[model samples]
Target: MDRIDVHQHLLPPGYRAALEANGVVAAGGRELPDWSPASAEQVMAGAGIGSAVLSISTPGTTFLSDPAQADQLARSVNDYAAELSAAAPRTFGFFATVPLPDVDAAAAEAVRALDTLHADGVVLLGNARGVYLGEEGQEALFRVLDERSAVAFVHPADLPGPAVPGVLPFAADFLLDTTRAAYLLVRNGIRQRFPNIKFVLSHGGGFVPYASHRMSLGIFTQTGRSPIEVLEELAGFYFDTALSSSAAALPTLLTFAEPGHVLYGSDWPFAPEPAVHYFDAGLAEFPGCDEATRDAIRRTNAAALFPRFGAVPAPVPEPPLLTRLRRRARTRIFRVIARAAGRR
Candidate 1:
């Protein structure tokens, strides 16, 4: 099967320098993996990936305290990725990085990347600085994304809180981080309002599939909305099988994700070669997936999302204005409730 890996990471020279200058050597409790175009190609070839959509892993520009510095680094790395894709259009594509928490600057960079550089999409950390995706401060960025109908790949950063003793963030907290962002996106009605921007959650949507009902009930308790409606919205987000393609996780992910919403992801570099092959093998051998579904996961679904890969994107119908208004209003109420409960 021809595989298109959507959840791959690229550590550009400039980015690596930035990390070092900031005295940051680890992410999610793991040392950063080394990467180069040659190495990336070798790994992809061995893994049977025909194409890989690249993005910078966690701590994306968040480590930089200065907005200008963060924006500069984001631009440099995006340029590097664009050049690689230009060299080999079929073998490589990239998701542009943005200087988030600097909302205007981030929006500007996203536009430049999508229109000028032709990035496959943009990668967003689950939380930038301390701002989560659904927070009001992120509205401007989301508006820019919605206008372009962009694809936003949600990757996790280290938790805002201190790491527990002896436990690495990537081992477990990374999952919670993605789950939090997904919840807020649905709770704040981002998915409904920004219907055009396709959101892909990494690591099989973290704890989303497993804890969806509990989350929906939590939302229902706050907004008085139907739990079923909330659950449906939660299911609408796309999921990638990265470290989540195990026999146990695969079935839940496959069952929860809507048809065409589950995509292949290797989480390469960050996830070492052995782990990548192990999970890839698990996906290949999973009996729950038929040939058609496996094909879809490997390439077809991604092609449909990224027309640059040579498949036509299916047209999505827009929700009525009145419905959007109601949803936005309800989402606002939920936000207020969260605020009152001392959550951010």
Candidate 2:
């Protein structure tokens, strides 16, 4: 299928230089790299991806302590993304950045980015300045997204609490942060209250897939809810396969999530290796899916979430002869194996 990647990132040249000049470090104190738009396009093209939805990854707009500087950087980043999308209409779409720690300013910027800039959605770090999205002070931000029916792209950010020594923080902490936010939303009734907002969780719902049994246990034993109930609610949530590209993880995600609930994503610039790895893993492991289901995850699901790519062509269909041959081969193999086992 002609794939649409919904989790790419584009860094403004000026902003990137500033990060390097200021010695700003990302998770694990790794110095930020100079991620340019050209590099992003090259990577996407090399992967044979048709289009990508760009978002600010981490150390988000609020990284600058000064609210004014934060706002300016956010605006610049959004404008740069919009400009890049214009240059290659078929190759790029963007999720606008918002400066947190100042709700009023962030709301205003959100309106402008959506209405004027035509941003596909808004990118929000899971925790901004140590505050989770559903917390009391951050309620207004959620209200804005819900009111606008915006796609809220939630990615992991460093927590405000003290870091543990000898632990590679981001590797584990990032997924845990996503899990924490998702759990908070469900427990606090945010999903039920704000049905209009569409939340897209990065990294295949971030531990939600593997730990689902425990979630079900908690509900049945303590909360009086079924796993199906939790899963159904979570089904309304969207997921992107960014870095968790394990051989087992992708298939497990397909089993847990309906095809329409998953989208293609590459947490680019920060870690392009994951993007390449996922494409390889998905292509090899998911060959059994029908074309329709494969098309949905590869491109259609993202197009539905972000209408910018609504007009992009669907994947070309496979030939009937090839399909028949594969089916026959599978049947023959099964028959041979069964006879050898004396089932025949």
Candidate 3:
């Protein structure tokens, strides 16, 4: 089955340089790399991935303390993504970024991003300035997404809270933030009211799969809803296989979410090795899955989320140069494997 990677990221050249100039860093304090379109294409081709939907990784637009700067940054980044998509119609697509602290600007940007730029969706942090997505003031953004039938890609961001003195922010905080945002959305009726907008949670919906029972208990004791009811609502949500590729986590996720609700993603550049390793592990562990189920997760489901991908024809017969390279590479690898097996 052809694969569609729903959760890949591209750091626009301007944005990457801006972050470095400001001394901003990602979860591990690692400086952001310039992930241009060429670099992304190379990684995708090497991994045999057909297409990737790009988004700005963490520290997105939220870093600019100045609202005007943030707004311009968002526009520039989205424009860059649009241009990249124009250049490589099949291999690239993108989620628009918004300036969160300024909701009015964000809403305006959403319209431009969706209507003008033709973005597949909008990317948002799980929490911004301690305010989760379902917060009273943030309703405007959700309303916009609902009106547009747009997808919201939720990634965890660090929030103001107690933390282990030296522990890495992503170790547990990222999952906690995602759980908090999702819980707020459920508790506040955002899903019920804004059913048109699709929410795709990163990191396998974070802690939702594990703490769902507790969440159910709380809801029952506090709001009189059953666990099954909550789980059913959650099932409507989409999840991506970023870092949650563990044997334990994948089975639990599969049991809770249908194949159609799960999409393939690689949290590229940040931890490409882990993302690639996890995808391989998931396939091996879920060997019993039917071809349709595998195909859905690998490509079809993602195509449903981002329809432009469906429009792009898959690569045709390989160019002669590529064909020759493939043959030579395959022959060399086969010979090495045969020699190693004979020695063994």
TM per candidate comes to 0.90, 0.82, 0.85
Determine which window of 10 residues in candidate 1 has minimal summed lDDT.
315-324
Q: In model 3, which residue pairs have backbone atoms overlapping below 3 Å?
A: none
User: Which is the better candidate, 2 or 3, if ranked by lDDT?
Assistant: 3
Q: In every candidate, how many clashes are there?
A: 0, 0, 0
How many pairs of residues in model 2 come into backbone collision? Answer: 0
Give the per-residue lDDT of model 3 (tens digit) for 1-344: 25677778888778887887777856434455557677777777776678888898777877788999999999999999999988887788888999996888999999999999989899988887666766677778888999999999998888666667777777678888888888878876788889998899888899887776566556545665544566567766898988776676776676666436788887787756546766656765675455665666678778777777775333322224543464456446545544564475
- lDDT by residue (1-344, candidate 1, tens digit) is 36889999999988999899889998888898899999999999899998899999999999999999999999999999999999999889999999998999999999999999999899999999878878776788899899999999999988887789998898899899999999999988888889999999999999999998789879877776767678778888999999999999998887776678899999989899999999989998998877777888888889888867766545433433544565567557655664565543
Could you give me the TM-score of model 3 versus the true structure?
0.85
Clashing pairs in 2: none
Best by TM-score: 1
**How displaced is residue 305 in candidate 1, in Å?**
0.7
Those runs of model 2 whose alpha carbons end farther than 4 Å from true positions after fitting are: 28-30, 216-228, 273-275, 287-290, 312-344
